[model samples]
Target chain A: MTPEEEAQLKRARRGRNIALALVLIGFVALFYAITIVKMVD
Target chain B: MTASANPALPAEWRDFFALTKPRVMSLVVFTGLCGLLAAPGTIHSVLGFTAVLCIALGAGGAGALNMWWEADIDAQMKRTAKRPLPQGRMKRTDARDFGVALSVASVLLMGIAVNWLAAAVLAGSILYYAVIYTIWLKPRTPQNIVIGGGAGAFPPLIGWVAVTGEITLMPVLLFALIFTWTPPHFWALALFVKSDYAKAGIPMLPVVAGEAATRKQILAYSVVLLVVSLAPWWIGGTGPIYGVAALALSGAFLALAIPVALRRAVEGDAMKPEKRLFSFSVFYLFALFAALVADRLILGQGALS
Candidate 1:
């Protein structure tokens, strides 16, 4: 594969990784919020 | 799209997002949020937000599954030929997996965070659209949109259930409002896009019943929608504010629909009336719901009293 194609692949991988991380964080926060609300209620 | 055949190619985030049908998702989310806000109760803001989020995710999931299943049919129709799965921008298996995951996760989270009733309704709605409407009805029957309308009507009801933990007259009325409105809303578009449905072999109302009958049906459904939209006011569920808004809106809806019903389109004549009604129908729903929320906020609970 050409260097440019390899670099594009790397960029896509990095972007996907960041998106996955954000989704994980969102789920974690959502659960935390729910738990806190339940505890207080 | 040519690169999609390569197993190693990464799907663009936009392609995956397109699988969710974001424009339709936005409408679902908005209606769901409005229902949550308009329901008669106090809910923790965070919990309310969570419920809306779950509704949005569940809707997105259903859209993905529908697209995944209909990719082949969609490819044959000009209207949906550009969808991610239809265009080969995403693998059908990947879309199916993503849809199922989102559906399950959203329902489970909603159950855990809010109430089980809301979650059950959410799950049922997702399956209604993806399995019942897309898989069973759409290809087989002209009544697909008629019955499938129930799927879109669930969000507001689910949102209300999230707050109240049960169904009530007001939310049910809201459900009926959308249910009765869908036939006309969809049939108008079907009138203009009859060829697309014909090519796809999907029995849309216009394709099966002919344009004349479809026009009559559109007018009939519009009248029914008019009655249903006014029920919330007549049954003492809302105040004069919403009643007035509904009256004006439904009046305009009928006015727009009348021309479509009365005037037959000749070859080479623009289907301007049908197109106008279709556009107005969308705004009509949003405005009606907004008015419902406004009335509720201003008058407080039991505003009709």
Candidate 2:
């Protein structure tokens, strides 16, 4: 692959990774949301 | 990826991993854990971990089977064109055999090591995803994701069954929450990947219904998911902590969905909001399930007996 294509691939991989992180964050936060509420109760 | 005859090459390892759909498996396992945590009874430590392991392996097995079956069509989609099967790093028959082995072995392990209820659920999940979703619903209709969504929703129910040895309203509600979430979540991906679906001759909602219809359905489903996510709290399955957090997150999810639903269909950018919703949807399910676990366990709502 050309340098530009490699850069593009890197960018795409980054985006997918970011997307994955967003998924995990949501997952964790959902639990936290419920947990935090319970902590107070 | 260039296939090498070298036994220790890093590239071949990737093929094996890709066949399992690791990202999807992570989500499946997490949800399964949440189900196990939220069930209204005690589970032995060894049995708990074994149930989770079997679920993870079973999910991975089912995913591998999906790739093996869809290898031909996968090469046609940009998002999936480079998968191990399409890239020829893994042979189709090899993947199929591997999937079958894992599927049966996981079920057997779960049955003997954990509870039969959990094992049955796990076995059903594999069949639902590998056969019902992949082979039946996907190609036949635009509502494919709707029906196929059940496969993803099985984790919590299965997890619950792992502990209780039976089905219950609470886990079923959790299952419903994820089932409702899948359509909107996937429709968002479908919006952006419509061209890929179209090119591959797959009939996703965004492709068949057009942007306007897709957006409408997304918003509609989001509204329904928001309501469903909140039901656990209202129905007394979860405490107020879960109720409040689930409601707030559902509101945020809806806020994100509203704009996508209302946005004018821009030519190149029609997919932007859908993409955002897709990104958020992943978070939505994870957060919601986590909250359920947290409230029950950490906050002492009902985590441990």
Candidate 3:
């Protein structure tokens, strides 16, 4: 593959990884919050 | 080209996001939120947000699965040709896996965070849209939108169940209202975009039933939608706030539908009345739901006893 195409692929992968990380983090926080709420109730 | 085939460009996160059909998701979220807010009794705000989030995720999952299933069909249509699956930005298996993951996650989260009833309905909605509507009915029958309407109609019912932990008349009426509203709403757009379905070989009402019959059905459904929209008020599920709004909105809906129904199909002139009806139908639904919430919150009307 050309260097430019390789760079584009890397960029896309990096972006997807970042997004996945954020979503996972958010899911963890949401579950934590729900647990706290349920316990309180 | 299938996703397995090498593509010129790599897929990005945004392509994956597009698979969710975010515009349609917005309406789903809105109606679902309206249902939650309009229901009797207060829920903890955190749980409420979780419920809506689950609804959105379920919808997104269903949309992804739908795109995965209909990639070939979408490629043939003008409107859906740019989607991730169609454009070869993503693999079919990737979309399928993503959809399955999201659907399962949403249902489990909802069951844990909210109520099992809500989660069950959410799961059903996803399956209804992804499996029943997209896979089974859409390609096979012209009445796809009519039956498939139940899929979109589930959100409000699910939302209401999230709060009450049980199904009731008000939520059922909300379900019926959207179920009836879908035909006129979809048929109007179908009237204008008749060629899209024909080109895709999908059996949309306009393609299978012809423009004349489609128009008549649009009017017939609109009339039914009017009655169904007001049934909530008639049944004392809501107050005059919703009643008046429903009456005015549905009256206008009927008015717009009448023109589209009566007018002969013209080669040109941009199908102004049909387009107008389509736009109004969307607005009509948004306003009607907003009125339902306003009736409960602003007018101090509680949920039905």
Measured against the true two-chain complex, the DockQ scores of the candidates, in the order shown, are: 0.65, 0.03, 0.67
User: Which prediction has more favorable DockQ, 1 or 3?
Assistant: 3
Whose lDDT is higher: candidate 1's or candidate 2's? 1
Q: Which stretches of candidate 3 lie above 4 Å from their native place? A: B1-10, B301-305
lDDT of 2 at B184: 89
Give lDDT tens digits, candidate 2, residues B152-271.
999889888988898878899999998999998998887776778898888888888888898899899988988899888888888877898899888998999999888766665756
Give each candidate's interface RMSD in Å.
Answer: 1.6, 9.5, 3.3
The sequence of per-residue lDDT tens digits that candidate 1 reaches over residues B1-305 is 34444445676677778888999988899889889888988788889999999999999999999999988899998889988776776578999999999899999989989899999999999999999999998889888989889999998999899999989899999889888889899999888888988988899988888888989988999899889999999999889989999999999999999999988879987899999999999999999999988998888762111
Lowest lDDT 10-residue stretch of candidate 2 chain B: B2-11
Candidate 2 i-RMS (Å)?
Answer: 9.5
Q: Please, what is the TM-score per model?
A: 0.95, 0.84, 0.96
Local distance difference test values of all predictions, in order? 0.88, 0.81, 0.90
Task: Please provide, for model 3 over B213-276, each residue's C-alpha lDDT reduced to its tens digit, 9 standing for 90 to 100.
Answer: 9989988998898899999999988889999999999999999999999997766768999999
Candidate 2's error at B122, in angstroms? 1.2
Could you tell which candidate, 2 or 3, scores higher by TM-score?
Answer: 3
Q: Best-fitting candidate, measured by TM-score? A: 3
